[model samples]
Target: MSVFSDIFFGGLFQGSLYAMMAVGLALVWTTIGVFNFSHGVFMMLGAYFAWQLVAFGLPVVIAFPLAVIVMAGAGWILQASVVRPLIGRPNIVLVVVITTLAAGSLIENGALTVWGPRSKQLPSLIEGNTTIAGVGVSLHQIAIIVITPLILAALWSFLNRTRLGLALRAVAQNEDASQLVGLNVTALYGLAFAIAASLAGLAGIFMGGYRFMNPSMGADPLLKALIVVVFGGISSISGPIFAAYLIGFFEAASNYYFGLYWTPALLFLVLIATLMVRPEGIFASRSRGLA
Candidate 1:
C-alpha cells in the first residue's frame, strides 16, 4: 500500500507536468495547422533563458516572465519568418517537418555552444517535502499538481472571453473564411505560436526544478507531447489535457513496477495500442468530429 501510494501520487504530479508540455503542442496544432517538432526547443530555451537571467542578477519572479516572453517572441518570429513562408508551398507538411527538425537541431547546437554540454538545474522555488496520504512529495511537485489546473482554467477563460481568442478560433475552424471576413490570419497564426511558446516556457521553468536542463532536454518532452496530443485528439484542448495526465500516471506506475529501462518500451506500447484502437483519439473534436 505504501508503494502504491508513492507511485500514484508521484506519477500524479509528474503527469501533470507532462500535461502542461503536451497542452502547448496541442494548442499549436489546433491553431497553426502544423506539428511543431521544434516545440521542445522552445522549452529548452526557456529554461536556459531563466538560468541566464538569474546569473545576470534577476529574481525568479522577474526571470520567469522574461524567459517566457523571450520564448514567446521567438515563437512569433518562427511563425512569421520561417513557417509562414512555407505554409502555402508544395508538400507543406513535409517541408514543415524538415524545417522544424532543422530548427530544433540549430537550437540544440546553439545551447551547447552557450551553456556547454554539462547539465544544469534551476534553483528550487520551495524547499522540503510534504506527506500526502503517507506518501512524501516535494514542494515543487505539489506546486505542479496545484498549478496546472489553474493555468488551464485561466487559458479557458482567455479563450472563451476574449476577442483575440475568438479570432484565433475562427482562424482555426476555417482559415479561408476567417480571412474572407477580413481577419488578419497571419497575426492570428503568430499569436497562436506565441501563446503555445509561452505555455512551453512555463512548463520548462517548472521542470527545471525537478530535472537537469540540457540542450537535448526538449527532445523527450517533444516526443511525450506528441504522444499525448495524438492520443487525446488533434483538434481539441480538453482531450489532450486528459490524455497527458493518464499517460503520466501510466509512465510513473510502469517505471516503478517494470524498472526504468523498460519504461520507454512500455510507453511505446501504450502509444501503439492507443493508435490501433483510437487513432482519432479518446476525446471528441471541437468541430464536426474528433480530429
Candidate 2:
C-alpha cells in the first residue's frame, strides 16, 4: 500500500512537470498555428541560464526570474528574426523542421562553446523531505506538485479573464476574423511565443531543482512534451494536463514493477492503445481536422 501511494503521488508530481513543459508547446500550436520544435531548446537555455546565475553566486529566486526574463527575450527575438521571416509561407512543415534543426544545433554548439559539454547541478529552491501518509518524499518534489497546479490555475485565469488572453483565444478561434477585427496578428504571434517560452523556462527551473542540467537534457523533455500534446489532443489545454498525469503514473508504475528499460516500452504501448481507442484523444472535443 505504501508503495502504491508512493507511485501514485510521485507520478502526480512528475506529471505536473510534464504538463508545465508541454503547455508552452500546446499554446504555440493552438494560438500561432505553428509547431515550435524549438520549445525544448528554450527550456534548455533556461536551465543553463539559471545554472550560470547560481554559479555567479545569485540566489535561486533571482536566478529563476532572470532565466525567465532572458528566455522570454530570446523568444521575442526568435519570433522577430526567424519566425517572422517565414510568415505567409505555405510550407509550414519545412519551417518547423528547419526551426527544430536550428534549435538543436544552436543549443549544442552554444553549450559546447560557452559551458562545455559538462552536466551541472543547481541548488534546490525547497530543501528537506517530508512524510505524507507514511510515504517519504522530498520537499522539493512536493513543492513542484503544489506549484504546478497553481501555475496552471493562474494561466487559466489569465487566458479566461484578461483582455489579452481573450484576444489570444479569439486569434486561436479564427485568425482571419481576428485580423479583420483589427487584431495585430504578428504581435499576437510574438505574445504567444513569449508565453510559450516563459512556460518552458518555468519547467526548466523546476527540472533543474529536480535533477542535473545538461545541454542534451532538452531532448527527452521535448519528446515527452510532444507525446503529451498528442495524447491530450492538440486543441484542448485541459487534455494535456490530464494525460500528463496518466503518462506519469504509467511510467512510475512501470519503473517500479518492471525494469527501467521497460518503462519506455510500456509508454509506447499505452500510447498506441490510446490512439486506437480514441483517435482524437481522451479529452479531445473534435476531430483533428476540425481542430
Candidate 3:
C-alpha cells in the first residue's frame, strides 16, 4: 500500500511537470505550424534566468514572472526575425532544421558565456512536507502538482473564451482564411509562440526546484515532451497531459519493481504498446481545429 501510494503520488507530481512542458511544445506546433526544435533551449533559458535572478536576492515569485517575460520577448523576437523570413519558402523542412540547429548553438554558447559551465539551483517556494491520506509528500512537490492544473485551466479558459484566443484558434485552423477575415496572422503566430515560451518558462522554474539547472538539463524534458506529444496525439491538447501521467506512472512502477536500469526500456515498451493500440491517441477525437 505504501509503495502504491508512493508511485501514484510521485508519478502525478512528475507527470504534471511533463504535461506543462509538453503542452507548450504542442501549442507552438499546432498554432504556428512550426515544430520548434529550440523549445528545449527556452526551457533552459528560463531555468538559468530564474537562477540568476534569485541569486541576485530576488524572490522566487518575482523571478519566475521575470524569466517568463524575458522568454516571451525572446520568442517574439525569434518569430519576427528568424522564423518569419522563412514563412513563404517552399522548403519548410530545411527551415525547421536550420532554426533548430541555430537555436541549439545559441543556447549552449549563450549559457556558457553568461553563466559559465556550472549547474545552478533555485530555492524551493514551499519547504518541508505534507501528508495526505497517510501518505507523506514534499510541499514543493505539492505546489508543482497544484500549479500544473491551474496553468492548464487558465490556458483552456484563455484559448476558449477570449477574443484573442479565438483569433489564435482561427489562425491555427487556417492561416489564409484567418487573414482574409482581417486577423493579423503573423501577430497571432507571435502571440502563440510567446504563450508557448511562457509555459516552458514556468516548467523550467518548477524543474529547478527538483533538479539542477545546466545547459544539458533541457535534454530530458525535451525528450519526454516529444514522447508525450506523440503518445497523446499532436492535434489534441488534452492528450499529452494524459499521456504524461501515464508515462510517469509507468516509470515509477518500473523503477519500483524492476529497478532503475530497466525503467527506460519499460517506458519504450509501453510507448510501443500504446502506439499499437491507439496510434491516434486515447483522446485524439477531442482535438480542436481541422482534423
Off by over 4 Å in 2: 287-291
Superposing all C-alpha atoms, what RMSD in Å does each candidate have to the true structure?
1.7, 1.6, 2.1
How many backbone overlaps does candidate 1 show? Answer: 1
TM-score of each model, paired residue for residue: 0.95, 0.95, 0.93
Per-residue accuracy of model 2 over 1-291 as CA lDDT, tens digit each: 899998999799879988998888888888867788888888888888889888899988888898888888888787777777787789975786687669657876787689987778777779998899789988888888998999998888888999998898888888999999999988988888888888887888888887888887787888888888888887867888888888888788888999799888878787888888977777788654543
Candidate 1 lDDT tens digits, 160-253 = 7998888888888888999999999989899988988888888888888889998888888889888888889878788888888888888888
Which lDDT tens digits does candidate 3 get at residues 67-157? Answer: 8899898878877776777887878757876887697678768898999887888888698988886789888889899889998988888
Ranking by lDDT: 1, 2, 3
Candidate 3 matches the true fold with a TM-score of 0.93
Tell me, by lDDT, which candidate is best.
1
User: Which regions of candidate 3 fall more than 4 Å away from where they truly are?
Assistant: 133-135, 286-291
lDDT at residue 181 of model 3 (Cα atoms) = 90
Clashing pairs in 2: none
In model 3, which range of ten residues has the least summed lDDT? 282-291
